[model samples]
Target: MKHIPVLLDAVKDAIGDMRGLRIADCTFGAGGYSRAFLDAGAHVVAFDRDPHVANDANMFQNKYGNTFRFVPETFSHIGEIDGLFDVIVFDLGISSMQIDVGERGFSFRADAPLDMRMSGKGMTAAELIAKSSVDELATILRDYGDVKKANIIARAAKEKLPQTTFELRDLVFNPNDVAPVFQALRIAVNDEFGEIQRALAAVPNKLACGGRCICVTFHSLEDRIVKNTFRDWTTPPGDARLPETCPAPFKLLKTVTPDDGELENNPRARSAHMRGVIKTC
Candidate 1:
C-alpha cells in the first residue's frame, strides 16, 4: 500500500502561508510532508535516517532544485544544520511503505529476518531479543507495547530467541496481540523515543523568532513526549508574585486530529494527533 500522510491538511493549516518560509521536514517519511511544504511555496530541507528514502529525496532535489535539500541523517542531529528554520515539522513513526515491504520485518504477516532498524544500522530486532534477558524483554513489552502477557511472552521469546518475524509472532501465546510485541521491539531497536527527545531539544535553538514547531504523533508514548516538551517550551519562568510579567519564549498552538473524512480515507490516521508551538522570543 502507498504511504498516506496522516493529518496533512491540519499540518498545512498550522503553518499557514508558507511562501518564502524555510521548513525543516524532520521525519521526511515518503516525502509526503516535504512535497506539501514545497508545493505551498516554502523552501524545505528534508531529513530521514532511512536510506530507502534516498530515491524519493533525490526526486525532490531534482524537481525543486535549490529550494529543497535532503539530509541523509537522523533528525536528532538537527542542531548541526546551519540555517534557522521558520518551521520544523515531525511526522513520527514508521511509514506504510516500510511495513508493506515484507523484507523490512516491520510487520509480522510475512516471514522475514527480524530486522526492524529504521536506518538499517545498529541492533536488529533479532539481535535485540537475543541480547535482552526475560525481564528486560518484559519491560520493553510492558512499557512500549502495553502488552498484558508481557512476562509470559518475554520468557518464551528469550528462551527461543526468534530470528524471524514469523518465529516471534508464532512464539507469542494466544490471546495476546502480536502487533504490540512487534511495535515494542521495533521502538527499542530504533531507539525511537530517544530520537524524538533529542530532535525536539534542538528545535528552540534551530527555530527563528516567531517560528513554529509541529509534531504529528501516532501513539501515546510519543504524544506524551511532544505534549510535555511543548508545554515546557511555552511555559514562563520566574515568581508569580513579582508582577513583572515574563512572557514565555514560546506559545502553544491549537492541537489537531484527523477529521471524519480523513479517518474514512485513512484509518491509520485515527490515532494521529498534531500539536504545535510558536517561538515567541
Candidate 2:
C-alpha cells in the first residue's frame, strides 16, 4: 500500500503560507510533508532515522537542490540542527512502509521475523521478549499498548519468545488482542516514547519566535504527551513562591482530527490527532 500522510491538509493549514520559511519535517516518513513544504517555497530540512529512505531523500535533493536537506538522524536529536526553524512538523509513529512489509514485523497480519526497529538498529522485538522479565513485559504491554490482559499475555509470551510474527500472534488467542500486543512490543523495542519526550523537550528552543510546532500523533499515549507539553508551555508560571508576571513561551493554537473526506481516502488516518502551538517568547 502506498503511504498516505495523515492530516496533510490540516498540517498545511496550521503552518499557513510557508514562503521563505525554514521548516523541519521531523519524521520524514515518505517525504510527503517535505514535498508539500518544498512546493510551498519553504526551505525544508527533513529527518528520518530509517536508512531505507535515503533514495527518496536523494531524489528530493536532486529535484529541489539547495532548498532541501535530508538528515539521517532521529527527531530526538533535532537540537543538533543549527539555527531555529519557522515551522516544525512531527508525524510520529511507525510509517506505512514499515508496516506493509512483513519482514519488518510491525503488523501481525504478516508472518516474518519479529523485528520492529524503526532505525533498523537496536534490539529486535523478539530479543526484547527474550530478555525482559514477565513484570517488565507486562508493564510494556499495559503502558504502551493499554492491553487489559497484560499480565496473562506477558506470561504467555515469556514461555517462549516467538521468533516470528505468526508465532507471537498465535500465542494470543483473541483476535482483538493481537494488534495491541504487537504495538506494545514494537514501541518498547524502538524506545518511541522516550524519543518523543526528548524531542518535545528540544522543540521549544529550536522554534523561532512566532514559529509553529505541529504534531500528528496516532495513539493516545503520544497525543497525551504532546497535549500536556503544549499546555505546560502555555500555562502561566505561578506557585506559592513564584510570581504571576512570569511569561509563557508558547501559546496554544488548536487541535484537530482528519475530516470525513480524509478519513474516507485514507483509512489509516482515522487514529490521527493533530496539535499545533506557536512560540511566543
Candidate 3:
C-alpha cells in the first residue's frame, strides 16, 4: 500500500508560506512532510532513526540537493543539531511503510517475528516481553495501551513468552485487545514517549521567534504529551491576573483532525490529531 501522509493539508495550513524558511522535519517517515516543505521552497533538515528510510532520504537529497539534508538518528537527539529553525514538525508514531512491510513486525495481521524496533538496533518486542516481569508488563499495557485485561494478558505473556506476532495475538483473550497489545509493545520497544519528551524539550531554544512547532499525533498517550507540552508553552506562569510584563513564550494554534474525505481514503488516520503553537517573543 502507498504511504499517504495523515493530516498533510492540516500541517500545511499550520505552517503557512514556507518559502525561504528553515524547517526541521523531526520524523522523516516516508519523506512525506519533508517533501511538502521542500516543494514549497523551504530548506529542510530531516531526521529518522530507521536506517531503512535512508533510501527515501537519498531520493529527497538527490531531488532537493543542498536545500535538503538528512540525519540518520532519532529525533531525541534534536538538541545536537546546529542553528535555530523557522518551523519544526513531527509526524509521530509508526509509518504505513513500517506496518505494510510485515517483516518489520509492526502489524499482527502478517505472521512475522515480534520485532518492532524503529531504529532496527534496539531490543525486539519478543525480548522485551521475555525480560519484563508480569507486573512490569501489566504497567506497560495499562499505561501505554490501556488494555482492558492487562493483568491477565501480562501473566499469559510472561508464562508463554510468544516469539511471533501471531503467537502474541493469540495470547489476548479479546479481539479488540490485539491492536493495543501490539501498540504497547511497540511503544516500549522504541521508548517513544521518552523520545518525544526529549525532542520537544529542545524546541523552545531551537525555534526562532514567530516560528511554529507542529505535531501530528496518532494515539492518546502521544497526544497527551504533545497537548500538555503545548499547553505549558502557551500558558502564562503563576496568576493569570499578573502584570502583562511576563508573556507566554508561545501561542496556541488551531487543532485539526482528519476530515471525512481523508478518513474515507485512509482509515488509519481516523485517530490522528494535528496541534501546533507559534513562538511569540
For each candidate, what TM-score against the reference? 0.95, 0.96, 0.96
Per-model C-alpha lDDT, please?
Answer: 0.90, 0.89, 0.91
For all predictions, the C-alpha RMSD in Å is 3.0, 2.4, 2.7
Per-residue lDDT for 173-255 in model 2, tens only? 77888899988898899898899888888887888889999999999988998898787777755533222322345778878
Runs in model 1 deviating more than 4 A are 239-248
Clashing pairs in 2: none
* Candidate 2 structure, TM-score to reference: 0.96
CA lDDT, candidate 3, residue 27: 91
Highest lDDT against the true fold, candidate: 3
- Writing each residue's lDDT as its tens digit, candidate 3 over 1-281 gives 76889999999999999999999999998998899999999999999999989999999989999999999999978778899899999999988889999998899899999999999997999999999999999999999999998999999999999999999999898999999999999999999999998888888878888989999999999999999888777776674532242244688999999999999999999999999999887
Flag clash pairs in model 3. Answer: none
Off by over 4 Å in 3: 237-248
Better model by TM-score: candidate 1 vs candidate 3: 3
Model 1 per-residue lDDT tens digits across residues 65-173: 9999999999998999997999999999999999999999999999999999899999899999899989999999999999888999999998898989999999887
Which 10 successive residues of model 3 have the least lDDT summed?
239-248
Count of backbone clashes for each model? 0, 0, 0
User: The CA-based lDDT of model 1 is what?
Assistant: 0.90
Model 1: residue 175 alpha-carbon error in angstroms: 4.3
